[model samples]
Target: MTYVSVQTQIYSPQGWDLSDIYKSFDEPKFEQDLTGLQQKVAEFQHHYRGQVSQLTPEEMARCLQQLEVLSEQYSYLDTFANLVFCANTRSSEAKQFFNDTKLALTRIYNQLLFFNLELQDLDTTQFDELQASSALQQYNHYLNRIAQFRPHRLPEEAERTRNRDMLTGRFAFVQLYSVHRGEQDYEPVATPDDKQVETPAQLEALLFHSDGDVRYEAYCSLHQEMERHNGLYGFILNAICQDHRIESQMRGYPSTFHKQLLAADVPESVFRLIMDGVSDRIDLFQRYYQLKGQAIGQKIRTCDLNTPWTADDPLLKLDYKTGVQTLLNALKPFDVFYANRASDFFSKRWVDTKVRPGKASGVFSFPTFAKHSYLSLCYTEDYHSLFTLAHQVGRGLQFSRTRDRQTYFNTQPPLLLREVASIFNKLLLFDYLLKEAADDPLRKQAVLTRMLEDQFNLLFYQSTISRLELALHERAAQGSFDHSFVNEQWLEFYRQLCGDAVEVLPEHQYDWAGMSHIFTQPFSSYQYAAASIVSLACYQQYQAVGKDFIPSYFDFLAAGSSMNPVEALRQTVGVDLEDPATVNGAFYYVEGLIDQLQAML
Candidate 1:
């Protein structure tokens, strides 16, 4: 049987037009926003910069209010470009608008560099007086955040140069990789009936193909193709590491990864728990692999890992409209404010759900706050796709609240806090599906097993990878970027974690190639594991408290980057980051789920 490549172009359905974000780039409002933002940035510099340190409390308050307005305007315009390009990445006009807008914003931002620098220099008496003022007290979180960074504050020109260089150099490696070394030749694999499957997506589906030979052939073939680019991938990896280590030294950071954790207010022990906890639980993964092999009556191969748990015939998939409706029905537990926002998001085309050729794989929701959250993904009606939708929508809700409550400087929320909303949505969907499938023993077992497997992937498998990321940076900090030694260390880590049941394919030892984090953002992969653990604790809170939990959850969303991550979690969901129990609680929850799945089997 020939399996078609899952092109996302076929998923579009009517009533999902994205013009609600903005009619088109030609709209008069787009031009107005652009011109208005440029003026605001110029005015801010002219009015506030030289005098910000000496300003009275009232004057400082007024400046912040103006800054907030300017932030909202920029978000609205940027969101419009984001929504447009996400809808159709191939649109040259949309792409050009984004480029033009970004360059303009950068010019405007260069003028606002004095805001933080001047504030850091404020006299202690003046700063304390401002903090005591009613108008600024609400922004205490924001004030505290800036004060914390005073130690790292550099001379304005030097800091500005470093920031600009980072974007132009270290950050550009991933973009270069995407351009030069992306997917290549199709080299189709033959099936038992003598047909071919070309794309990786097509090859993926064959993991469930009835013929074992077909699954094994596609597995080896896919990895073989990826192996051809090893040298190129290693070059990219080396460049990224060298850049990070050099910057960390210049910035006076103890370690490269330490810089990332400090910026997010995360502790090293929090990461260590995830890494070590996952390593300790490899036996469970071994059991899972053994059981999977037994169920399929064949040894598990890399490609065969993704096959469906059941042998049922594939169902006819719904188009995007029907998919949105299905998602809406699943999310009915939230209040009308939440539900209506989600409804508008789908109807207004906040999500670019169709898969177009050359569009990036995987899904991401860009949350600009105040204006809109844009989701980009190659959609399908698969169960996994639904989970992806849930993830994005959850992020949208958090963004919605933050935009309403915080200013632009505080908009990002810490990455540590940001992942909670997205992961919470995944948990919500997972719980709902588990309950819905409770009646059917086999289907329940399959769905729950898959859900647990996903948890393991995020909470365990990714945690191991996160450790390798941290170790790589530490070694690099000491001036060692030995590619051979690093690869061998990675293999050792995986071998210890995976145990005897699973074989690490020889070529697959270069697993680090697939990690986009290493090339793009250093030491950021651990956030997945950190957030996964925190999300589980938050999920339990939701279960225990029900509707009463909504207010606290919303408060968490609204906190943005204003508070340290540990303080934010404690304030929002009552999870104490320093306590080993919080991390251990996450593993215990997954272990319970695994035990439940095993009982069903």
Candidate 2:
């Protein structure tokens, strides 16, 4: 089996232009906005404080509109500072500006905190009347979302104290972890031609290197560096977990997971069902690994899990331009609007694809309420990089639509639905590749293998991490634990997930320390798994309905947080996250792919 790389003039990817947001921290507009936001917050506090419940429906609508404007102003400042810092984590100027912006926002948030508390305390009749009022119809969904948090609402003073404390608590530690990780360097992989892999994204790219030895060395290099700061990373994660647990207890939430569920407006039973469904499908995950091992003619190891099955063949590398074109072409057939939205990310330079010193690792599409979203990734010129671009572009496109269609309050989607567009784009790319292969058996097999491996990763690997997080929170609830405890728990979960299909290397225990989500966004892994399931179901619908599915899919992305995620899914894609059939169907789809791969073998 052989494949041709996408041929184009190879050019170094460009950094995103932040000028659209603000030319720099020194920009007059940036400073003006910062001052303007503080003034807005103060005005809002003065006008709405302690009077939210007493306002007529018309007045309430006006207050809500004012709050939305204030939020957009604050997010604009915060997003700029954070994006600049992310582009250069080592810059003291950037870090200081980011911290300063956060401090200012924190103060503003404290002043505005009373508004939400007051609204949460609104009497039922008034709240219902406001929802029914013509003037407040646009904000009815926003009001309902706030109402859901009433039971968890702390006293005004307590909530204000907590908001202020987060600057030095959870948020501070997360920033530390991000900075520390950005600074660590990994030993160069000699087998990979003496390449120095500094950023985590570079090291991760090496995991998919065609050479098994290169993959192993890269894996060791990553974990060894993480192991060096195991204590620090562990402490950060523990502190985060402890913080969440404490907050949950104080808020009268039953558990940390329960709090996450409430924030997503998802039921605990739904999350549990997804977790249990993935757990029950461990055999399918193991089978895929075993098949990969057989295909490569060697027993799989933790490092080799990402190794290309066609190890002896030269890897297919696509330049940034070609990658963008490939994604555009794939998406054009589905919907021109989506394709055009994705193209804007590249043509408009909204993506930072350059790998350089002090830049953060990992890929992300960050959407701003006041401006277009920005994406960042270390593009390595491989198929993986191409797919990652599609994934992030999917997110950018989804958010772009929401920003255009929904208000600032409804712009961000729930965690469970957040990954749907991204995963759906990946599937679209997969189908395009498979179609391009046509009658070429080897090409079809390669595409099938990559898609299957990704599914296994999203479903099983992510679920395993989610389980480890659950265990960590439970331990944190019991008492204090150190880095060693985290390492042990990670190893246990890894072994349980891998079974005998792959050898669990010693360094694998420290792998969890390298995962940013565990430190920054706990329980987010479950969302990845849940989104994968929902995405597969959506993909199946797309396959069944062809072009008819495109509009509804777009609607799903545009829905944002305006409605319950469960209802949104049911309405847009007809996917019911609570249905066992949906979970089973996703697994069955994976099984069919596996069978196809096995037949090819």
Best lDDT among the predictions, by candidate number:
2
Candidate 2: pairs in clash: none
Q: Write the per-residue lDDT of candidate 1 for residues 1-601, one digit (tens) a residue.
A: 2312211222353223545456778888878878878887987888886888777777787888788788777767766665665444455786577657666665666677789888888877777788888878657777876776776677788777765675467655665564333335446899766877765545544655656678777776666665666667767777788787787677777777877777767778877776776676667777777777777676665555556555662321345655666566556674545656676566566676654444544566777555667776655546656666777888887888887887776777766677788888778777766677778777677667667766767766677777787777777666656557557777887777667656676756666665666676666667777888889998888889898987888899888876778888898878887787888888788778777876776
Q: What's the CA error at residue 392 for candidate 1, in Å?
A: 1.4
lDDT of 2 by residue, 171-231 (tens): 8999999999888777766644555565567777888888877788888888898889999
For candidate 2, what is the TM-score? 0.96
How high is each candidate's TM-score?
0.87, 0.96
CA lDDT, every model vs. true structure = 0.69, 0.85
RMSD, every candidate, angstroms = 5.5, 3.5
Give the top-scoring candidate (TM-score): 2
Q: Model 2, residue 141: what's the lDDT?
A: 78
Residue 169 displacement in candidate 1 (angstroms): 1.2
